[model samples]
Each structure stands twice: as structure tokens, then as C-alpha cells.
Target: MPHRSELYEDIPSVCWPIVYSPDYNITFMGLEKLHPFDAGKWGKVINFLKEEKLIGDDLIVQAREATDEDLLVVHTRRYLNKLKAGKLAVDRGWAINVGGGFHHCSSDKGGGFCAYADITLAIKFLFERVPGVSKATIIDLDAHQGNGHERDFMDDQKVYIMDVYNRYIYPGDGFAKRAIKRKVELEWGTEDTEYLQKVHTHVEGALNELKPDIIVYNAGTDILDGDPLGGLAISPQGIVKRDEVVFKAARSRRIPILMVTSGGYQKRTARIIADSILNLHNLGLIDKELVASEAENSKVEKMIRDSVTDLTNLSL
Candidate 1:
């Protein structure tokens, strides 16, 4: 089996599979205005969830930063980085990593502001360490093509990729396009109606075509109507509905799924993410058995929380 990893910890049933860490947020000065991605949004999403009383800090799993050994599962030695939450997905029926989705990164190279291949790592970890998880399907809904995972799994038949992206946008890599089993290229300003319809059709078709052991849903909100980089135009409501479509499909098939919030440039993107998770709970797609006991007060957990709070003040 793969070398023992702390990533595959025995999670308490009282906690939801949703994974996050305070270090997930990247805040440095006031640069959130200049970049195409809101670096501080991850923490904001957690705060929104807290505001809604959907979950408490101890009720969600605390994600550990992937060590170099953990990253080597799917990354090149020269390009190693961090990721996890796959094993958690298998333990629970589903999981959502509030701070990943680097679709522009591959094992050998990183591009479009994405520095590591998190999605690729998540799948490979499962195939190597978890039984009955040999096959995986990647449903990438970012406005930009998920060239990173595509390149990493190019010749691997055990992996299936369904990408929906704007044809005119960045990283228009034709070579990477070949790896996508189901590709939906969109026009400029493609609104909710056309975007959602095509996504729904391709998602269902892809799932129908192959029943994989697990699903990796790369939910990138950069497709929101006015994103400077993403040329497509999809409304926030459309984005929520799109996530619902994917979750419903995975639930219906009883397949374990891991979701990564990949990209979204707008300031409101964090709220949208928390809203989608809440919507999923509202629809009965994801739920937790709230234990009557109060939250665990482990010393290690307190240390991690304090460390992350300090790191969030620094640049990522």
C-alpha cells in the first residue's frame, strides 16, 4: 500500500467531511483588488457558514498541509506540492475542500496562477491507498480548461475527464484537449440558460457513459458573469444550480465525491460557495448526524487554529 499518510485519519462521525484550514486563506496587504482571484476568500467562506449556523469549527475536519511524501503520489519531484481530502470522501459519501482547485497546474508545470496539481493528487491517493477506488471521473466546471489534471492523466484509462470551458480564454491548449473524454467549449458571454443546459447534458452523459468508483468535482466560480479572466457569463444562481446538478448525480449513483472550490475572482465568490453548500444540505444531498456531545477540544486542534490565524495574515 502507499506509505502511511496522516491525510487518511479516522474522522469522528460527528464531524462533516467538509475539510478546511485557516492557512487556506492567503491575505497579504490589500492586493485582493488587483489579482484575478480573491486570496482571502477561503476564510470568508468559513465565516459565512458560521454565520448561518450550518457548522461549528470543530464540526468540520481540520485539513493538514500535505507533506512532500504525500504530494509525490501524483506530482513530479521537481514540482511537488500539497493536497488531501480524498480518503475522507471515501469514508464519508462526499467531501468538499474549501480551498483547492488548481486546474492550471500539472505534475511537471504550473500555469495561470495555479501552483500545484491538487486535483491530480486527490485521485491518485485514492487509487493507491483506498480499496475499490481504482477508477475516477473528473468533472471540471471552471471557465478555463483544466489542463493540469488533463496532462497528468493523459494516458491513464482509469481516469475520465469532462471539462466545460470558454474556448477563447487562457491556456487554450489543444494538446490537453485530447485528454478530455467529454468536452464542452463555450462561446463568449454564454449566459446561464445555454451554460447550465450544456453542463447538465454533458454531466449526465458522461456519468452514463462510465460509472467510475469516485468523482472529483472541480467547482470553479470564476465563470460568474463579469470575471475579468473567464469570458463566459454565468450567474450566481446558475452556479448554485450547477453544483446541485453534480451533487445529485453523484448521490443518485452512491458514488463518493470530493469537491474543490477551484477559482472565482469576485469578492462575493466566498458567499456563493457557502451558499451552495447550504443549498446541498437543504436539498438533503449532504447531512451530518449531530452528536449531542460538545465539540472536541484537542490541544492539537487549538494549535492548528492559532497557527492558521497567524499565517492568513501573511502572503501564501
Candidate 2:
């Protein structure tokens, strides 16, 4: 049968930073509130894509608000109850901010930064609704580990998680795990070349091992050189190249991906992430936007391969 587009079909390009801040309110994660960081940054990106004529009016910008049931997929009933009670402000593990952040959320509870639903909700939504979409692999490249996702899918064999996080930090729980934890930890003050090498290595591994039907990409921009929360110092060009690498890999493998922007505390986050996503759209990895021409596509292919080789050989 020929492929058909679903929710992402009508909308050639949609940006999701529409959910109100209260939906992600967390008081214990030490980080500030959600603010307009996601939306504001995403808006800049979409506008650029539109100006570049990469997207059309048919694109649907769905505001993803997580329901209680969505949260229940990987969380426990007791923890769910705490969240509903609004008393999650006290416990570090259940605290909304901690779990809300997207980095530290575990299966039943939350950690360092993850508070509520981010990739988990998207994955569940896609899995339950989309046909022939059973298995998934979460590609998380935030400066911090995707501890929440790793723990959530630890025993489920249905989900494969490949994370590239810093070697040391808060909520240190990624190493020495029983599952397929492709944890690539860069030394503090790591540079961009070293970062991309690890991303390429593990991403290649994920393609071979899990053989996922879909990919949930946590396109975090915090790994950039001057990010407020991240430890690495990747150049802006390096970050854009990284996204191209990820998107190309998915496309070559014939995998469909649902991208959810995760981390990136730089003041210029919106611009950076927007550019990266545009690059992804340009490469035809995401169906929401127009694909590049043969010549442009060839350039992207070379850039990704060359950058990956450079990254792999860096001394770090």
C-alpha cells in the first residue's frame, strides 16, 4: 500500500510551543519555569521556513497537552495521584519541575529536570494511533542524560533509547545499566567535534540494533558552546550539522520521526533550533516541509558524513 500522511499531513509545518506554562509547572527542579522559551524559539524557526517556502498553509500546529492517561503509560498510579493532588512541589522525585525538565524523569517518578510529558507523550500518541508503528527509539542529545526516558523504557524492549549526555552532573544514573544504554558521556568543557563523533557512533548502533519503526528525536540545542545549562562548547555550525546527521540517518533507514525539542538554555535557542529543524526539513527526514533539490541534498549528505568522521576522530 502507498504511504499516507496522518496528523502531520494537513500541516506542512507546525510548531508546538502552545501548551500553557501551568501545564508544565514544576517547583523543585532548580530551573526556572517554561516561560515562552519553546514557543518563542519555535516561532522564529517556522517563520524562517515559511519565508524560505519550505512549508505550506496545510501544516497543522497541534498544541500537545498531555492527559492523565498519557502520563500513566510509564508512571505509577501513586505518582500520578501525587501529580493530580498538586502536592508534587515537595518531593524531588515527583516534583513537577524535576520531571518537567525532560532530563531526569524515571519510569514511575521524575528526576533532575524532567517533570511531566515530553517525548513519552509523543511516542505514545504515535504508537497508539499510527499504523505499523510499534517499536521506537528515542534519540536524546541534550547536554544532560535522558535518564527519564531510559528508565521508563528500561525493561520494555519495545523502546530503544540512545542518549548522548555529559559524563557527570546532577541525576547521575545513566551508566552501568542492564538495558541497551548507549550512554556517550563527554568530558566537561567538551568541544563540538568530539560531540558529533559520539552522536554518529551510537546513532549507527541504534539503526542496527533496535531496527525501530519510528524515531522520537529530542532535538536539544543546549549542547552549544555558550548554553547556560550545558557543559559542552559546540559551535553553532556543528550543532546544525548534527541535526542534519540525525535526520539523514533516519531518512536513509526509511524511518519516520516525530521530533520534539528538548533542552537548550542559550538565549538564542529559538534561532538555533529553528535553523536545525529547517535543515532537517530540507533533508526530507521530516514530512512537514519541502525536500531539498538533488544538488542541495548532495551537499547535506557530504556535510553529514564528513562531520561525523571528524567528530569520531577528535581527542576530546
TM-score of each: 0.87, 0.69
Query: Per-residue CA lDDT of candidate 2, range 1-316, in tens?
Result: 3122121222111422111122233344644455423434444555555676755434323233334554555567777776642111110000001112364666567655455544554455445544555787878777777777666666777788787777676557734244445767678888867778878878988888777866666767778887767778998888888878887787677554445556766557666765775665566455422222222555533332222111100000
lDDT by residue (275-304, candidate 1, tens digit) is 999999999888763111111433432332
Q: What C-alpha lDDT do the candidate models reach, one value each?
A: 0.76, 0.53
Clashes of each: 0, 20
Off by over 4 Å in 2: 1-40, 43-58, 84-101, 125-131, 174-177, 287-316
lDDT comparing candidate 1 with the true structure: 0.76
